[model samples]
Target: MTQLSLRNQLVTVFGGSGFIGRYVVQKLAQQGARVRVAIRRPEEGLFLKPMGAVGQIDIVQANIRMPMSVQAAVKGADIVINCVGILHEGGAQKFAAVQARGAEVIALCAKEAGVKKMVHLSAIGADAASGSRYAQSKAAGEAGVRRHMPQATIIRPSVVFGPEDDFFNRFAALAAFAPALPLVDGGHTKLQPVYAGDVGAAVVQAALDDAAAGQTYELGGPKVYSMKEIMQLTLDTIHKKRLLVPVPGFALKPLAFALELQPLFAPPITRDQIELLKADNVVTEGAKGLKDLGVSQPTPVEGVIETYLYRYRRGGGKFEPRFS
Candidate 1:
């Protein structure tokens, strides 16, 4: 283990129970930091206790929507990390409220608490002028953080994947069941699928490094792949033989928009999300990414999928050799 001591330093991680948050908490805990995971419902984060030494982690109920709760969570924190985001809108959890205003609220509270460092998790496509609501909200969140803490570090990652990721696994599973999987706009859009663990480590590195202050980093994997290539990789990993059917955006976008209306139930597709897929989700032009983050080339999907996707095979395991 690296001997950089963060012992007794308090870090309040918003949405630390999430897939990416778990990895960040693990890294910080190993470094001997006292981590406080702030979630809307603290009970949901109890599983995080096992990731750290006894009494090293704390779970607190804090909804970003509420100023008082956010303020309470920021109390005694040396550093604050915001991982809160939503792909779809919900009651009281709209994009503007959670991603934009909620970020401002958290930054304000962290500043009031005299926190020394702050990190905001954003997407690679975060642009104030973006057509997608998700992209726009991410940019707004970054602006919100900068407004309160000018020295805060903002990290923008391409699609993050891991064992429990919602990206590859979801599509791979559909490939197993369905005859063909639809590729948005002929799968032309490109993406650099960085591992979730890599993103987590990058967050930790930024928090500990003074030079990273007031800077924005775009994190991506070593190589870039088209959306079609990602789907093909998923198929190969799962040992599933399937054809990728490209759907014209003009034909499918309307249906997706209608499907997103029922936010009450998890929507298969949303108009905003469909629009997002139209743009390449790779890293920015001249941003320092894995090289500066102290991480070697990020883990590729090819090596990771074989480890996790085996469970989804025909026999619920890897393919066994057949006797002649």
Candidate 2:
């Protein structure tokens, strides 16, 4: 099979300014593809221009909730990737509107615009019957995408970690100030933490490989670790000895709710997030993953976490002696 060439191809990525989306845009730019970053605010995405040569990357204002704007974003693009997703609901950004309906709108717009291929980013725990509204919304979004573009490649990734990721970075920052870290539900929930860059590479592969059409890939790292182990790893990396306290779901709901009410851009933890932690976020056994999508060796958390996490260590970890 002849692989598609991304050189000079116009690829539009919705939410291209986000944590995961930036990596996708960078990968596409590296492939010599002309990247159109569709974001809510053009100014917010202007930083992406340096990822490519002058004029190779263009930032356009787009909101998936607005069909006309989505149409404008998909117009004249050979491929489209939807990376727009939210962890929690906020004003005008509900799970249903952004993840579910927003995905459908993009898929439908791409189909109408005569796009050659499409890729959709989804989460591992997306399920219609799941208790978490976040999961249910993600499942709905996948369904909507399939309904509109049957040949679209859907990539479901487990907990993704990187320099800008919230998982490890959040806990590591917490340990700097707090003496202990709360292990929700004893932190028993297992997760296969795939690197953000690998997932981005997988998305690019799915776009270029014809066989990936109509396929679903679950991306995970080389190893799976429980939530407790993940927290311990953070402490170990930052040279901190913080207590891992086990807190049940019922006990944390009140606090989660209060946090949600705060005006912070991203609350420390939300009620829906607590519900999401109930289920394991690992890739299924024997499921297709990063290897199948051309990412031969997905990155492990320990391999790259210290690059950004060292700042949280005491005295910035500069004066501390290296501990074996």
Candidate 3:
């Protein structure tokens, strides 16, 4: 479908200050949409203002956990986008509360407001039967959206990567400091990392096209890489050669439990995350994906990862390649 003008359309993007949300907000801004970035802290998303004209973008304080706040955010918007999700359960942000119930609140509010288009962002491994709480909550969120607004567009993107992403950069940071990087479950779990921008484009496209209504699009990248391969690729990008140590998922369980017992900076890997890697995170065969929405070939990881990972090289940014 050809892109339609979003010049005067009001789009309320929940979690618009996040990594993927920032890209989505920028894409919507590019389409000349008046974006209402509804996040918990309006001040945090101040950076998004420059993406659009003087008054084209606005950030209002709203948390989906609170239905009244979400209702107000979607009240006058023409379209609503929910990208709010949490990897770990923090104080008041449990997986069921935030990912599942929060999604329900947003969808209900959008429906009540009579929003024309609603785009809900989910993950590829969102299955209710999955052992992982993250995946189960995501699946519940999808069900919530469908129940509230039958026509809402659902996008299940496989591991998104970009400059500001956690997947590549986290592994790269590990390579820079750690002598050896652990390959959980022998790093056999397959992942198709879709570029954050490509996801943003697909998301904005869904919002603009009427054909996307009542559809679910599975977005993936150009190629698939194993978990170990991804770690190796990150090390290669950062000009490092760290030993890839094979670590079984079961061995990490006790450590994850101990860390959860006592607070630290951030747990290296949560138990739920470990459960998630047990299954391949890729687009399923016959599932509607990027190409189905006019994105013939999504951007590859190499195109964007090296640009930022280079910062983690042994030397500074201008350092010559060690083994290019």
Number of the top-ranking candidate, with TM-score as the measure: 2
What's the TM for model 1? 0.93
Q: Give per-residue CA lDDT, model 1, range 1-324, as digits (tens).
A: 222347788999998988788888988898889999999988999988988999999999999989999999999998999988887886788999999999999999999999979989988999889988988999999999999999998999999988777788787777778898888889999999998888999999888887888889999987899999998888887788888989987788777767767555566667787889878999878888877878887888786767777777788864442110
TM-score: model 2 vs. ground truth: 0.96
> Alpha-carbon error at 115 in model 3, in Å?
1.2
Best by lDDT: 2
TM-score for each model: 0.93, 0.96, 0.95
> Which model, 2 or 3, shows the larger lDDT?
2
User: For each candidate, C-alpha RMSD in Å?
Assistant: 4.4, 3.3, 3.3
* Comparison by lDDT, 1 against 3, better one: 3
What is the lDDT, from 0 to 100, of the residue 151 in candidate 2? 96
| Residues 58-81 of candidate 2: C-alpha lDDT, one tens digit per residue | 999999989999999999999999
Candidate 2: stretches off by over 4 Å: 317-324
Worst lDDT window (10 residues) for model 3?
315-324
